[model samples]
Target chain A: MRSKKEKKEIFLFLPRKKPFTDWSKLLKNDFKLKHFYKSKDLLSALLFSPPQAILYYFNRNRTVFENLLQLKHNFNLVSLAIILVLEEEDLEKLSDDRILSLIDDIILTSSTPLELKIRLSLCLHRLTRISDNNPLTGLPGNVSIELAIKKALESEVPLAIGYVDLDNFKAYNDIYGFSAGDEVIKNLARILQTTILEKTTNAFLGHIGGDDFVFIVPLSMAEEISKEVIQKFNALLPAFLNEEDLKRGYFIAKDRQGVLREIPLLSVSIALVPITKGKFKHPGEVAARAAQVKSVVKKIPGSNYFIDRRA
Target chain B: MADPSEKRKEVKKKIRKLEGLPALPPIIQKLNALIEDERSSLTQIADLIEKDQVITTKVLRLANSAFYGFPRKVSTVQQAMMLLGINVLKILIMTSSIFEIISKEDVGLWEHSVGVAACAKILAEMKEVSDPQEIATAGLLHDLGKVVQMIAFKEDYEEVKRKVEDGLSPLQAELEVFGIDHAEMGAFLMMQWNLPERLIEMVNSHHDLSRSKKYRKESALLHLADLLVHARGYGETTYVGLPPFDPKALTILKVDPSEIKEIYLKLEPRLYELKFFTEELKREMT
Candidate 1:
């Protein structure tokens, strides 16, 4: 209900010391600012009314900054931009990729008010470009998916990357319109997302373009997550299909070869490839194995997953 | 006072840009507890949301919103919750405002809607309707226009009630006062929100079976369910007696006369189950 014309809210956490540049004059008329001295206060306020961005003046309190970042991840506050303000002496901290990935941008204490304002606006603009989420499902797109896979390859903990897609999806899409097809895709995305999120917090799920999805989870939880996803997908499938198609259990549609035949109802196929440290050098190798596993899973029919056992 | 025609236009324009309706406080409190509890399953949270019409509509609206790129496909609470993860749902519950200090009449209306939803789902199951949950959703939201009237057009709503007290039927009173009935008003808003067409049709035609074109059976089922709940006295509505019953609903649903008793028998236990929750909500309101 918040109107577009309303001033964007920015939560500022500055030190009580009077040595810094005046923030009020700098952000005057451009933003509605709420000042927070304590990190806990800002966090509690976020629960009720989240601001467009958080300007945290980071000192030596590494724990507080890390806790704030963890809270953002725990609550999935991906859109709430965090701009860190650091002293020039603390410039070396920017070399940490973890901190860099977590915060939107950094502002040096010596920058003028005009430079600070421009940096804030640029940070907000970059937030949009960085979010490569699939518009339909709001899941991360190929860019993030590749990054996640690369991270998984380097992870010391054993991880499983599941390549998920639909069998008979094209036939269903052909019979039903594009809107219904999109619904099925969204439904599958939900199944994968919720099932994976329920199992572990160290997991990643993304849409690898139309009908294709990828999820990275601990190797131990991969099978259970896949089974749950398949079960949920099957249970919610009937809601999307018409009574006639549901009654017949399949619909008559043309196959890719242009021959008319009865195509089975939509079913999901997940090809899970497990990764241990130093097993696969690149994400491409994992993709190659998953592609092979997917062929086997797709041939078996019904909703199922195939875990690649070969090294 | 504005002319009835002008008032109708104003209401339509307001609903077209409608953001949300205020939900009862108790429901929001209960939802927050359910969502914040780490042990609660998604189904449990979804079940709680399904009980309240306002929250249910809001959930469906968000899931089917253009931002999600699922403009009318998502219908059930479970489906919507799946798309909107628990974190987003938590934020939604926190932002949801309550009706300006809950009143007894509002509680009564909430109970009535829950009752109708239950009864409709029962009938849908009995008739082997596809997507019975969606039908139940339509049942819960069937009276949404009345809620809109209470919030946006307080004077017009009071006027309709006064006319009803003077022996005019609630529908006739609404038509005379607002130049549009609640059924049409609710449907207009639903269409504006881009809800599923089947749901819109069912809500739009709950009173008049003739208006239902594609989803006649579903609409007829809701019509019968509304009457049955009213007859059972589970909740209160503006109607002094049973609103005009279209016997054709029974014919359209292919429900036999003997099935009426069966429906009542099936509905009694569900209403009894819901009574506990409604009573608790009332206690909290006071």
Candidate 2:
């Protein structure tokens, strides 16, 4: 069953070099590699079989560089990844900006097998993570949020993780429908992003799909950022709700079990977890802590945040 | 002769001053609004398109065209809407109105457009592109600028044709006489009409595939469709050889050089069908 998956082939175009038999043996199981010796043959082979990726061994030849750039334009380097293998001295001697721009990564030829594997894994991981952004809100999604959290933890920053979601959002969505709900989510994303930008230069805002959003800011600025987000969201709520709903302060909505209830106008609840808790290592731990705070915060009436103090 | 830059400025002024390029029919705007409105129903869009008798007939004809290949005949506006969906139907209506302008100016150009549209449809389907109808629409409207030049600037059009007869390729003649070629002109008109940006880019950069960033694959397919139609001598032409094939576009499109023969073989029968399709449309209009 695994073999039924379409194998992603890589085209390897390299100049004459010593002992590349080992290179072929290295990639044989993972990728079906097609080797091209002459520059002209590379063009023809690319025309016939468009590869998932390209591995080019760099040289100082002008014609080779031109052909590669032309090929990149043809294949759209945005969709396809091109990795360049070059020696340190040759890379310095060539010093060509055009070649550097066309390629996605440069792997020094002197790197060990384990190093090359790790670099390729990291490159693929980054590509998939970037492409996984939410389509509606265009914010980093769950995978990217996890990766960002992991990176922030590794960097040893005094990070404060805030998990934010809407209060009474389900009732609003039930009345207004999915499209209006989507607009509300997008508006919240904008508010969170703008409020964080106003407070600090370095912060990350991510959407975990639906109406849920998460942000990571420095520990000192957490309360300020959360307050600003609540204020901004509160100001925009009247515009989203009708005049009658605004005046009445609540609207008739059905609870999940089909009971009619008067739900208050939309508000937000944010759970802030400071990562200096010593017990939190991975993103899962941070998310678990946020959930515990969120349960307590939702019991309040208006938009507010609850910080986890149970460390 | 004036310098190329000076002549280009003059041509730009001429384009700006010219009138009678049909206003993009009001129906297209309504259709865009309908597409954007979350509450809009398909029946509403179908009823709106049906209000315009001219577009109604064209949309019905396209729904029945060999390109769509519905097993049963799609006879009514509602039936056509169900089969073709809203986006494809929107493009069909837009192209049908645009084709009114193309068919009025020259029958040969109309035939050529039909040929390219058929070829692009086949190419896109073979490549498994998500929207074959959009690609075919791009192929059909790729030469729209030439129609504008023929209608808007007769004297310049005569000079361009004369240069073509004197043995410069059609593109080279267009450049010598008009400063800019028909690709840029068609792209400019598309932009003015508020067509989708991808379609506009396809028209603007079909001649130069490298310049296209977002719609390069679509543009490359249109470029090759134009060349294939010209190769078969089906469209209006002065009998120059196939336009220069960008090796880069071929690579990007992933079309094997050997597959050209197979594509042509598949396109021939479709061209014959579209020929009848064009004539029937013309007869209905008259």
Candidate 3:
């Protein structure tokens, strides 16, 4: 697994050219580039250490082109972005079809090194910022959250999956419109984000869509994060509700059966499922146990978080 | 010799008269309009996609798929736009509509489409194609005409299947019965949908790679991808035995003969993921 912050470099496979031209100097400043003259050198280097990007110069030789195409699967496997540079007339050979179908981008060899730097940086920036964040709260969505939990389980780490849900969200949404209800969800997300940031830097926050937010953190730091999130969420509940509802401490709303009943003020419940080694093989298992714990915790009063300490 | 133009006109007329021949979804037309508009923002295009629940869901699903290897989960249409960009999203929307229609007739064909999509993606990556997504989309909908044939001319399609069961290839059967192959019929539909000329050419010449004048390389990519999927025994079709590899296409792709085993080895593992994905798609669409 590649760490998030590491020294990343690009590998350039170009024909032999004079060293230290004006254009090459521009790229040398921002990127740590390693130049390879032969296909064998590049392929061998990739086997030992994969580069973030590959800059290939197209020569009219069919053998060289085929050899380069052979490495595309390997490049994709290691998440490498391939940039091809070819002459204008040489580009005409591929003009009859979808010319650059295999690689990430193509540039005219006539372009300046500054243009290359800008284009390459933009592509690299995009590669780094691939986030599947929930639209409402901007927290990571289920996929990222699930992937994190699975990685932790695979590593035999002491992680906790905290399943957070609002106890009377539907009742509140009924009294207030969906937009206002959305605001409350966003507020809760903010509370979770801030609590995790303030308490633990390594924690992962995700929105499991609609009134359900999940956070995965180290087991030791899980209790503190969950408690702080619940505390902050409860403290902000009054501002979320109207003055009339805040004064009454409850609101009259219809249950699923349409029967009128007084529902208590909105409170959040957190069910922390500790991910122990050998206990579970997948994230779905953690989700199942978290649901069981949530059923028990949601029944209790006020904002609270409890860890499921069961086999 | 017969006039090729006269034959093409007749084929176009025959395709237009086919019963239950569906047009491209209205959303695609709207998205295309937005794409061409220079003033349109990504937010505006995403907003239009958000109006359609199915497309939105599919977009998010593809963004998070293994093909993109997007590091984070893509939840919203806006995020999917950033990950896939407009070109890929357009192709995805078009194919999803086609898949929805064909899935009703034959679940096996849908699996085949998914399998072809995965294979084409790998092949395109191998060739260093600039737009793998477009080629993958073409692979997914390569058999659009066959589905239409089954829907419009049920009896004729039944005969085609019967012949296929008897060991005649599906293409040969279509030619025997209808005087036109599915590749031709598929190209006709692509033309009707106002699809990209490159895509139309690929579909038009997938079976006859030599005939592809402009999109020879792309057509070859799809041809090889289709053959690879057939060899893998995906999609419970009556057609048996792999289609002979097109020498012209092989030459155009510059693929080494020795690389066939390697291609199969890489494509084999991804087939499982594609099957799982197709099942999930069927569940969601229904």
Candidate 4:
């Protein structure tokens, strides 16, 4: 793009758009970068072409570039300009000149590796997150919870495992249809992500398919958070039901038999044991013991109950 | 004397076999080679591409996408050539070819590749650096190692996935899981392909700019470019999150945090535009 190399000219012009597809067009055409605009023609001469020269281009708007700059990799906008060299002869003499120095300044300010690095991390992060993420309830699925527990056990930590089953959930589901039932389950899940995680707690929360949920708490805070969970459930139960349902002597819902049945209000049945304890050794054992308690709670009239491993 | 050494040797062998993930996918290696050669004729380029029938069709499909946004469907390689020009065409070909290779990845490494590539191109130009095409390539390929891990060690990858979600940098999770990283794999792949040393250096040193002593500036640039995209929060995998800034990288570029934000907003629309093409490229390539 530079002719005769006489005036040692230099021309520079900023492209108005992103991708600078316009600028890309010029470079691909063998035109000197110096020819962007008429006045900018000296760009070729300004830099020591085939000539050695360093260049720089920093993003004009700071926040966007800075946000991108936060990535874990080394992303310097300036060095990317250096990568654009023509890679030819005339290397040394052109090396250190002030007028030519401006070219490096220009290149780096516009685009660089840092920007590219930032862009890739965003895309990769997206690819890594699970799409099946339960939005209504942040609790992980059966598999994720299993892995978390397995890992905790592998690390030999002091852990508390609990299986939480809602009392009268089937009757409720049959009465309200699945949506209202979902709202109840969602309310319960919220309590877990929020109320149950205490400072001393290392929690693993999961939705085991339907009405059953699982929790893994640190040995120290497991009882406190567990008690808090039951209290919270009792406190919040009234809000989910209508005035008529609340005032009614019993919850009016269809039984699994499809006949209308009056049932006690909602409650939770929990089975908890410390991971470090010998009695409830494997996760399956804890789950089975918890299930036994949950099943027993169904036989009684109260809302929810706990399986005291000590008992 | 009965070989305490043999047992050690056996252990060492077992570990080595399990270590160093598969190199970058084969299809990527072939295409990158084809594009890097300036001496290669269009026929050579087209022939090598056509040798893989699936790749050729995908290239044609992507060539027609808005990334190129030609008026008519481009059925032939030459037509694609005429539409996208040599550089853009090469980039499209490389990108499409890459998608084809990464198509099987569940980790969304390929999707992330396209997003980062688009973001990289935008940031490069915004700063007026010449990273548009080349930088985009690096952005897309930076995590090829993860792809290798996804295929080779699914179980470990899943475990590492949770660690990352719970907050571990990709590099850290990698070390935790496989005791290796994409950088080493990338560096090895780049070398195997005999790519320009500069690209290999940039890829290997992207995570740590200080490691790139000879190519310090370029290494630092790639590092910064990678971080910028992470901060944008564009794609899914939120784990292997942003690395801290190197003060030297700032002094060299004469840039500040304020400048990064300006470019991020400016880059958003352009990224969206590229997505139109990238998706088309993926669909066709796959």
Candidate 5:
């Protein structure tokens, strides 16, 4: 529904009965601003039509600010820039990661109109640069995926980087059409995402384009998360396949060579590459090891995962 | 009075295009408390959500909406919560309107649905059915048609309730008043929402076992769970006594007379737990 030509929408939540700086005169030319005096109105509007950014003037309503931050995190509203307008004394609150991580940028209440304008533009500009989410699943794309892996490699904590892909996906697309294929991919993405989230909060999930995905979790949680993903994928697969194909457990589709063959129904293969302090030098090395593990996992039966046990 | 058949068609059309349904205020309140708490696990939140059918269905509808591109794939609350995440859930609970100014009767109906959900899960586990949580979901949603009737067809719903009070059976009153029963009406909405076919089948056939073909066992389990919950007097329905039970449900689900007692024993504690939670919510509401 969003078009490039449309004026960027920004929601402004300001304190009631306060003599704060009016932003309408400054922002009217470049943006569409809707003002909200009540927190409920602001939240409901956010749900109905999420603005590109929320300009919240901080005051005594710290709870409202926290709720906004939580909403931004939970909904994964990466594109919604939350710019806080607070007094200089409020700068101490920024030290809290919970508050710091959620807000896109901050502006002082005493700042000139020009400073506010520049900061808002910079926040919006940064969102475009960092938004590497896959269009299909809205998950972090290849760019973030690589950065997450690189961070894991450099971090001292042991972590597991999982490379997930679908088995027989090409055949599924050929038989059921492209839309159906996309549904399967999204389903897998959900399974991976939710499973990872359910297991631990300190995890990363990204869509590496098409049917492939990448998830990074603590090393101890890798196998458990993989098992859960496989279990959930197998459980939810029936909804995507036709009843006849589900009953037969396979469908006759043309192979890459153009010969008819009994292709198995969709299943997931997760290649887990564990990273210790110095197990891998870079993200590429991790990918190469995952490729080797993936070959082994794909060769086995339906919805399987294999962890690279080698040093 | 309008022709029941004509009314049925109109109601079906409305439900097919139904956009939103209100949830019980108490459930929404409980959800807020749970979600705001820093330590509430996803499973814990999903457990509370599964107790209320209206919220459960709404959650599933959002997850399976065409916008998500996974229509009919995300059936259970746990799965839907995973995909929707905790943040969206906070907004959903905050934004969800209260059920037409909550009444004691609506709270009772909520209790009945939760009781049936608990009983169905126990039965599913006893029978070793795959995805007991899903069967529990079916039980929770079995009376979604009643909710639709109450919200969309208020006059006719009161008429049906009055007829039941006048000594007619609930299903008979429903058929005479609306040309269709709650089971089928709820099923139709579920189908329109693109919920899983198995779930739709179970909801459609909860009152009538013969209507179920593929998921007869699940339907039968839900049917029995409904009866057991009613008999326990854990919650109130339009029926003064137990609704008609299909004897064949026992055979289909392979439940024995002794096993019924066992299910009751298992259900007692869960209902007790849920009762405490609901009572707390009611107190908070007051």
Candidate 6:
């Protein structure tokens, strides 16, 4: 039912809700779209629209930012965006100095006042929610993995820690600029998410900031997730590296000091450590142990290593 | 064909005239003259200040003001001298002579003047220039015109104050008030006192360095030093206007604008030292 021109241009389809909810108060006034969702098509005929109120509002709330990012429109984010401006009086009222002050105190509640410790514990229950994890590789960041391991340990459950490193990232970064390196990081992030998270009941995926990731999965699915990571990575990684690099038997990589060195072609090294309350006092210790085992596996050619806490 | 030094001297003399500037106490003049003499002794210096009961009292008060952090009360001018030493005595003489009870009613004027004096001395020392002492003397008197304006044109001065707050240059604000500025008056007083040509030029060109014909180097240095002090936001709120920025002044002084922040950070710790220096000078004057 879309016109040829409409089909060519990309647009984000925000949920069309009637009369907006009280939750709309969390949104900055600038983000509100003019021309309420009366019709299927977006019309730009409204007067008193700020040229870019949405940009300001988007900065305040990144979920709306994620909504903007989903827009398939080929235009740069700036050119494609427009905001619904309010009257001056309304803008001033919307700034809501008192509400901001109240919210500041509310957020501060968790971070302060030892006398309110009991209240914070009660409030703490509300902040915890289940998290989605990368499936192709389960590795997330150290912080989340530490939390996940803590949760697993609390319930005396089996928790698996996976440390994922790209086999020869430096060579790719040297050939392509840092932007391409960032893509590799993102692509690998998604790989881990898809491989390790898709099946596990409770999993966490995080980027440990640059080329490294950590994943925490229930110990029952540890071997399954580990095999999926290696299988998917082997299948997907060749496509990411260019044709010539793939042709060469050994991929060339720069070591830490930037001298070019030959590295064994595209492979992943994962260390699966089974979390035990006796040995793993904290999630951090498990992640650290996994990293240590990862370095040892990285020494071997093309592999994954799993250390049962019993061993 | 007025040299900046000559112009500055002419201005200071005029300011001195306008204010009927009270004389420096005879004891201070004697001490200053003695210090300048080929043969001057600590005992002689101490004895001269001791002759005046008021000066001795002031000297003892200064020694106690934590400027020295002396272990025991300094009961006499000699005891104060022994506690502070000769370098401190010289400073005491200079500050006391200039500061003479600048009424607290006009809170920051004296403070600003002292801050400028210390800044000029510090700057001159950094340049390894000769006679940082004379530079300090010049800076102390540089704002003599403000005093002149304060006394002569109170109403118009307020207008100038408003103009400054509204963002006019201090020179512009001064022209609105007394048809001239403190730099001009300060220079005139320096000339009347037969101060060195360097001091005179410093006063005249402290505000408008680029305009000076002679003593350009001294004027530029003075301008740079004045801006540094003004930026410090020390002293009184009565600085005639926002201090002007002269690119040429910094270039002449070989001071980078970026370096100002780091240099100020280094100088912050020395504020108490400068305060002590000022308090010391004030005591000697009394």
* Candidates 1 onward: DockQ, in order: 0.15, 0.02, 0.01, 0.01, 0.30, 0.00
Q: What digit string (tens of lDDT, one per residue) describes model 5 on residues A1-311?
A: 54546989888887653334355678867888788887766775675457898889877477767768766655566788999888999788679886777788888888777778888999999888777888787788888888998899987878999999999999999999999998888778767765676568788988889999999999999999989888777767766787689879898999999999999888899999889988778889999999999999999988899999999
Candidate 6 on B1-286: residue-level lDDT in tens?
2344554444445555541332235456777798777477657886456433234434544444421232122233444444344433444454453334444434355556666666766777877664565566556667766765565546556777788778887676665555567787656644543434555677788878755776676678777767777777666645554576778887777877787776676567766665654455456545
**In order, what lDDT does every prediction score?**
0.83, 0.68, 0.68, 0.51, 0.83, 0.53
Once fitted onto the true fold, the runs of candidate 5 whose alpha carbons sit more than 4 angstroms away are A1-12, A16-51, A60-64, A87-92, A95-101, A105-130, A198-202, B1-48, B85-105, B114-136, B148-234, B241-286
Question: lDDT of candidate 5?
Answer: 0.83
Q: How would the docking of model 3 be graded?
A: incorrect
| Number of backbone clashes in candidate 3 | 11
Clashing pairs in 2: none
Which parts of model 6 have CA positions greater than 4 angstroms off? Answer: A1-29, A32-143, A253-260, A309-311, B1-286
DockQ value for model 2: 0.02
Tens-digit lDDT track of model 4 for A1-311? 44554322222233445445444454333323443332112221221121222121232233322222211011111112222222233234346453242232222334443553343234234423643334445456777777766665654567777777787887778666887787677657655555453233346677776777787877767777777677767755654565467778468866767778788877877767556634444667656666676667667665444545553
In the range B1-286, model 5's lDDT, one tens digit per residue, is 7798998888898887676678877778778999989899878999888878888998887777775567777778987876676767776677677775655765778789888988988998999886788888888999999999888888898899899889899999999989899999999998887788888999999889989998888889999999999999987789889899989999988878888788888988999899987787667556
Q: Which portions of model 2 show Cα errors greater than 4 Å?
A: A1-311, B14-105, B238-240, B279-286
For all predicted structures, in order, the TM-scores are: 0.83, 0.38, 0.36, 0.33, 0.73, 0.33
- List the lowest-lDDT window of 10 residues for candidate 4 chain B: B66-75
- Candidate 3 segments exceeding 4 Å error: A1-311, B1-11, B17-105, B280-286
For candidate 5, please provide the TM-score of chain A on its own.
0.84
**Who is ahead in DockQ, 4 or 5?**
5
What TM-score would chain B of candidate 5 score versus the native chain B?
A: 0.95
Residue-wise C-alpha lDDT for candidate 2, range A276-300, written one tens digit per residue:
6345677787887788899999999
Ranking 2 against 4 by TM-score, winner: 2
Q: After superposition, how far is residue B21 of candidate 1 from its true place, in Å?
A: 1.6
Q: What level of docking quality does candidate 5 show?
A: acceptable
lDDT of 6 by residue, A68-184 (tens): 332211111122233322223334443655223212112111122232233323333332332232322223345565666677666566577777787666666776677667655
